[model samples]
Target: MTSAPQLLTDPFLQLPTATSVQVVWFTEFAGVNHIVTYGENLKQTARASTTKLSRTREDQQSRVASQNQDGQVYQKPVQRDIWRHEAEVTGLTPGVRVNYRVTSVQEDGKSVDSDVFSLAATPKSDTPLKILLTSDHQLKPMTAANLQKVVETVGRVDGVWFAGDLVNVSDRASEWFDDNGGGALFPGLQGRAKHEMTHNGVKTIYTGGQIIQHAPMFTCIGNHEVMGRFARTGSLNDEFDDTIPRVVAQRIYPDKSLIDNSFNTNTYEEIFSLPKSKEGEKRYYAVSFGDTRLVVLYATNMWRTPKLDGKFKGRYREAEKDLNNPENWGYGQVIYEPIAKGSKQYNWLESELNSPEFQQAKYKVVMFHHPPHTLGDNIVPAYTEPVQIIERDSDNIKAVRYEYPKDADYIIRDVVPILEAANVQLVFYGHSHLWNRFVSPSGMHFLETSNVGNTYGAAWGDRKREVPIGYQEDYVKLGDPNGLEPIVPTIAPLLGEDGKPMPYIASNDITVFSIFDTGTGTVSSYRFDTRKPDSEVLKFDEFKLKLSSLPLPPGNKFPG
Candidate 1:
């Protein structure tokens, strides 16, 4: 018997062009007909194209109904059937709003419909906009509360700029569609989440903001979005942590396709329909929104366990049993894609910086996943490939370790110089889940406003990072690894236990969010303490993206 078709997520907007926008949704069964009904009277319709998700799966750890039965546990990753439907509604007038809803007809002849929502085409150049800046919402406990506060405080936003790390695991169907706890990506963003929080014996349920249903969202690739070598193991978590470099994978299995041997962002790439670069389809690209030129880059790498116990493969070394077998090595936090000097990504960025669209825009913003300046611990060990050093006692291999040279940090040594030279106004990123900002002498601003869910303690004062002792390369334990002073929040900075103003808001109970107002050229950050359910969302920091006074050097142009 064919199971009843059910809509998994409310319809959301994506890839808004000047005259059209894409409406996307998910369903459990392959429906007979799926479409978008738009306009004031909902008379017009556009048919949707449906495709099955390739690698989404569920394991014992999944929170789905089947896996929730008593004594029921999937020992291995089991494929979960999910179908994505996307319809392009074209012939829209720029800056005009229209009512829209999605409907799916089941194979059983039954139909499902979503609540009516509003949408619009890309805004005109003169149209002022407010865009939400957030990231690292890995289904953390506070994500629902954080998003709930956004709607209450800001009311409505035009767009959402997500820096990355949408969920804990990209291929987990429940994490994206319907985690029983209601922390799934779609539920949290479409006001369907049922996440609950308790304080002082008082329990409150939080439904995340109804933002994406009305506005479009643009995102970059974060470390969490990339899944490791295809599921060869029973545990999805193990496969996620088992990625090797493409070069290494090729050497081990020269006969196999790269996608089959190495890591991939297949699930992520399949979900969104964004503007593509000639070099990078959706992995990296640039888009023009209103008066702003937004350049998204793929600059994230595989994050490994920081432990050095020699029992597990980690950021610093290979596991003891796997050292002898070359195919099983983790390869020490290897980067997924190359963006160093002379690389394809770098060349594309150079062309984008010099292009008329970027140079003439009123505001220039570049976004990626890794931080170039931060007070958090993730910035340590440098943003470069790890150097391997193996120790052998006469015949047998004794130990294998990796080191990162600080001077060879690509983002700092190469990317930053080009961005600074291009007079890029803002650099937004989030790898460290904290709220902090820094300004270079050249006046470019770097902000990390990813304190949306939780935080890993910041590195300052007596607080330090977990760096291996006696390593050949010296790692900075405190402060920004690239050497820039953190900028204190302007309106209301958080105070430490010593009564001194701290430059960051790294709290699990208090969540932070930011909004960029294009009309004022200012990015404002706000925070809400979930402990106090009725507390006001306090505006903590505000900074303007000012055009630098320095001029491009004479006869010094970006090389193609």
Candidate 2:
């Protein structure tokens, strides 16, 4: 049998024109580089043509895992999010059909390639589009049933909305050991004729690349990819010391710089080579498919800075001048810097919103990392409190460190308004790491899809958290429907002013999973406990998207 190509570039296809599609792949022509070939599949059989460029230093994340057997901890090689060498092909007419693959050069001067995949360009939508949406796919190959779930998704839907968090951190532990040749193509089946049994009693399979290669995906960044670097204490303005900007914690000891860095999804980036952002660069941007317009925002950057307006940010530092406080001087300063709206990104976003291109789109959906709405009654009680400082563009207010204007300022002041005025219909965020959806008073949908990897609890809204501390519309809990009494909420306890149980409410399985159609006007929620593959849907039919009938054009984007 012919051996696989050494290294293959991802993102097998691109749409340059309405009908033309470009196919990209990798080959070891000079070094690890990309080769793209295209033609009208409609004209005779398309012939393969090629181009080659070395894999940028960051492109080669392929490595074998190794470990020390002292019962201490095993270490594995870091995985680049995607395959190497992506082809950005275009010049196709819209609504045309095409097929492609990734041809990669391996370390042995040989090459590897992905299975052939195909897609039909965006045909002018005659009806509201139906995009299959699912997120938080935390698959562990250790079990048999879990592996089945991966197989189950193949050919099941039109296209997939793969929100982030694709692997288990511990899953790569095998990289530290070698049951196979050198790498981790398959965790347990190294030389076996077939992969018939499960590993560690859990089902496992390598399906990520397979799914991505075939599906013309509308992907969203998830918290798991950046959860380690997420500092919820404040905002992205919070500073860190990594000049190189690491994505995932390369070595694992909770490196501080990993705070805003990550590469988990980078593997997907390499394999798929999706569209990238102009300023922040790839991973956070919009993707349009036919009638769908997906606005991808970067939320991890939002909740990084700690809440410290001009007066108090340095207050703790100044007090530590003598260095004898026992409690570190930086204790309350919030590790990152104080954020302001006057920065360049704010202006760029405002301009993007004002663009006729953005406004003309029928459906506008925005995706990022942090939740704009508070899910529980315990934390801030309400979503709005003056947390961020707004001195330039507009809006001004002040309060406690985490209050709306001070810490929460970015979401409300810099981002949300632009989306709202620009006619964006839905927003999706994941930093909180659970399934949640909050509808704003302004008739927009706020959806959060996290927990693809790990999970925590979610707090329900409490009337008290809203009155005393809430300032934003999302934080202010609206009354529950007549028959939909809320499941009790829970929040971690801290000494209350009165020293009582804070009584915050949070739910664990309130995860967001369901079939949603912009045309149907509703998202019926379902909870699947992946722990036991076929476990009954935990909360059977408890929540339903309260779709507002306010008429809008059919959307081509997803509310990430």
Best-matching candidate per lDDT: 1
Q: What is candidate 2's lDDT per residue for 1-560, written digit by digit as tens?
A: 85554432244334333554445443434444334333444333333444322111110121222323322222222222322343444554555556655444445556555545565555454334444445444332221222223324323223445554432221232221222222222221111111232334875332222333333555555433322233222212121211112312444425544533422233334434456668645555565655556666544331222223333233112122323321212222121211135544555555555554465555666665445554532223222223332222233222222333233456665577656656666775554445545555566666554443334444432333223233342434443211122222122222335665432222332223444454544443444444444455332222233332333333433231
RMSD of each: 2.1, 11.1
Give the lDDT of residue 402 in candidate 2: 31
| Candidate 2, number of clashes | 105
* lDDT for each candidate structure: 0.89, 0.39
Estimate TM-scores for all models: 0.97, 0.57
Residue 260's C-alpha lDDT in candidate 2?
A: 36
Best by TM-score: 1
Off by over 4 Å in 2: 1-17, 20-83, 89-93, 105-111, 132-210, 218-284, 302-342, 376-408, 461-525, 531-560
- Candidate 2: lDDT of 539? 26
Poorest lDDT segment (10 consecutive residues) of candidate 1: 551-560
TM-score of 2: 0.57
lDDT of 1 at 538: 98
